[model samples]
Target chain A: MSLTVPTSTTLVELQDVHLSFGSNEVLKGIDLKVNKGDAVSIIGPSGSGKSTILRCINGLLIPQSGKITVGRTRVDELKTETERIALRKRIGIVFQQFNLFPHLTVLENITIAPRKILGISEAEANRHARDLLEKVRLEQKANAYPGQLSGGQQQRVAIARALAMRPELVLFDEVTSALDPETVGEVLAVIRDLVREGMTSILVTHEMRFAEEISDTVVFTENGLIVEHGTPDEIFSKSTNPRINSFVNGLGGRATPLHDGEGI
Target chain B: MSIVLKQERAKQLPFGGIFAAVLGLTVIAWLFLNQSLGQVLLEWLPYLAKGFTMNVLISILAIAIGTLIGIVLGVMELAPFAVVRAPALVYVQIFRNAPHLVLIFAATYIFPFELVIFGNYVPFPDWVKAVVGLAIPASAHIAEITRGAIQSIPTAQWDAAQGLGFSRSQSLRWIILPQCIKRSLPPWMNLYASITMGTALASLVGVHELLHSANDASTAVQRTDFTVVVYLTVLIAFFLFCYPVSRFTQYLERRLASR
Candidate 1:
């Protein structure tokens, strides 16, 4: 399959971003850029601020200092929640916990954002949601509630819900981290399909081999700083930085065999 | 296994068993006193039924008004600004801790006896005042329940809603409050039962509810046996109304816990 031409247009840029929660500095002077149609992945140990960076991009957490540009809006400069909400409309984020609305059916969950925020008609939103559910291979589960679905199934619904907004960029924050080992592969496969479709994605993931397989650029962060960033081959195999070398090899040593089973 | 057995044993002797035991005791008391329970009920049942309806009407109105005000006050307590939260907090604290009888008395006196509507003097009934009084404390208790219910929802729900571009109010209306409704139902039903029982206090202010009517029946009959029978009837009426509510609340709690 031929991939779309990767555009040079920058979709998100963060310059010297620093964020702290009450004296504990999380993201210390971080800088990064993601171009349109590029799949960038951030790999690091827990508490290394990989998720924090994703939160900053979506305007969920405000940095103490930095310039965050998403599309044309300066995210750091948003003065009110309304402004931030407007910025967020163009960005979608999936969390490790899935966080699907338990009270709503799968179809309602996916259609709610477009119907409520975008003022799309219910019929149109439902139609669009059905399409997205088909894309996620969950068309059969549309009427099922989140509680009725498996964790992997719920995460795919979350992804479908995000896509219902037609966002320019999507952030996946360790989405497979909470899944059972047997179920992780199914969620990863759905994400792989999304990334392959030229969706601009920034993933904060712990899946070493999967990241290497899909990411155009792989960033390595430790202790609130991006230590190095380069092509997947460079970061996964060719890097000489001892920290990156040891971390990659250490994860590889404990890595389980990839389960390509589609059944969740 | 022991705990499960204990729970099963506990479930075996439910409200019905206790109610049957109480009825047996009442029958024994009636036999010893040589009083005819049927005659007493025949004479006063109609009058007591009228008063009981008053209690039900007041309870329905008070709960409706209280729930509306409570939802607003509860949401206010969670407001981002202290200016909005402070007054709601103070209101909840004041009414929640205040004596229900005192609030009933205050409502009776605070509101004028009559209202001038369109140049007409309209009588403001005591029952209306009682409803207003009962609603104050009921609203406060409900506000606390609402606040707790909202807080009990995991913060991840809020984060996910925000990331989807939902405004805080939109998230609360669409996502948070729907879930809160289930969490709040058991407690809210418990509150309604208490509020229904609290309607008896309206009798002190001459609202002519079930308790007030029982007192009137006892005074008219001028017999100790008649008084006992009428008062017992009043007690049974309240139990009949509130017992089912509490049982349903427990059922809802168990279902929620299972989920």
Candidate 2:
């Protein structure tokens, strides 16, 4: 349970993090670090605490006992709500449900936080939001309400909304899992482009091929602990751990190919 | 040919016109048959209208104050700590259960006329007392609506807002409250219309609103025969005012639902 002062290159570090929900222990002593501009993918079976890690990182859920650092901010040690909000301002997350405000038009959904929290001028916020919409290939749907758009389109808008803040780090919690099989490609394409643009991200994804293609570090969790941590190649083909091997085999994919099938 | 065109034609149809015509004819026939009653009605219309003005004023001020009180209390009811939530729950329960007329009486008679703050006496006007009385029950109803509407929003929205770096208050203001407004509007309008009708209770406390004005005018005329006309005018005035609120609430409900 030693605390490490994350070096300059490490943008996020979780040291000995422990969290529980009443009788259920969701995360038991998780330690992980992501270097700046690195794409880290956390892949695991359901109930293995992959999403819980992302929630703790985003301050949506606080750890029972641990140290979490993003850049210089000690997230768990933040004393005031304002301080936590300041810390959160530097981070963004896109959820599986594409939680866009249904009552607002897509443009408004993207512009709200920047205009309200950052006190950015309306014109400037709109300009930035439009640029993000362009990136997600959803500029055409900017004026449409979330309900009118297809699931993939809504998820794209959500990604755009997260990007509008210009966050230093982004977390994607199974961003494409809820989409129709055909639509999943478009949403994943958006995330792929963001990774190419060097957005530091921690993605909790079941898309095995996509994760292997983008992740600089791959973490495998089971029973509320990290059972395997390595580069994509090491974790996919080189790791000899029986648990990691069985989990990869359970996905119905050969570890060497990495793109054997859809998802676990 | 087009749906819009069909809807426009539907709007042009005089669906309610026949009913209105029949009702109007019946009232006119009654007036003509009782010529002296018709004359008294004409004489008392303006006096009753003046009292209706007082009702409108009381409703507006009381609703405004009540909504503010409701928003604060509702937020308190959602507070994470028991120290803050317990008192707010108690406040909501007490005010919501007490009858509007009872609150009006309590505010008018039992409450102090003046407060000594820092050794200075601040006098309370009778209108202010009546406003307080009307606001109590209205505030409680609004608080309940606010609490329910806010809770009804999916938890995912809260997580999304938090992920975007919003504090609890900022999330409530920018995200939660906007959605709550849509969900809460119809019931809120219902509460308002009822409160506006509740302004009649202010008459018992002697605030001289619509009913009080009608009572004074009827006494002056000294004819129990014209009593029907006096009370009927007051009833029609209220109907004219409240019917629109109900219609607007329906309109908004449909509009929001389409979203």
Deviation of model 2 at B163, angstroms: 0.8
Model 1: per-residue Cα lDDT over B1-259, one tens digit each: 3356348547844756698569757955784666465666677889999999999999999999999999999999999999999999999999999988899999999999999999999999999999999899999999999999999999999999999999999999999998998788867987898889989999999999999999998888888877877787888888878766666766766655433
Task: Please provide, for model 1 over A85-146, each residue's C-alpha lDDT reduced to its tens digit, 9 standing for 90 to 100.
Answer: 99889999999999999989999999999999999999999999999999999999999889
How many Å off is the CA of B138 in candidate 1?
Answer: 0.5
lDDT tens per residue, model 2, B1-259: 2355347435634543454456556667778999988988888888788889999999999999999999888888999999999998999999999988889889999778897889999987666788899898888888899999999999999888988888898989989988998778867987888889999988888887899989998889988767766786676678678866766765776677656
Q: Pick the candidate with the highest TM-score.
A: 1
Off by over 4 Å in 1: A258-264, B1-13, B24-37, B251-259
Encode model 2's per-residue lDDT on A67-172: one tens digit a residue: 9999998988987778878888899999999999988999999999999999999999999998999988988888999999999999999998898888999999
Worst 10 residues of 2 chain B by lDDT: B12-21
Chain A superposition TM-score, candidate 1:
0.96
True contacts kept of 2: 0.81
> Each candidate's TM vs. the true structure?
0.93, 0.88
Query: Model 1 clash pairs?
Result: none
lDDT of all the models against the reference?
A: 0.89, 0.85
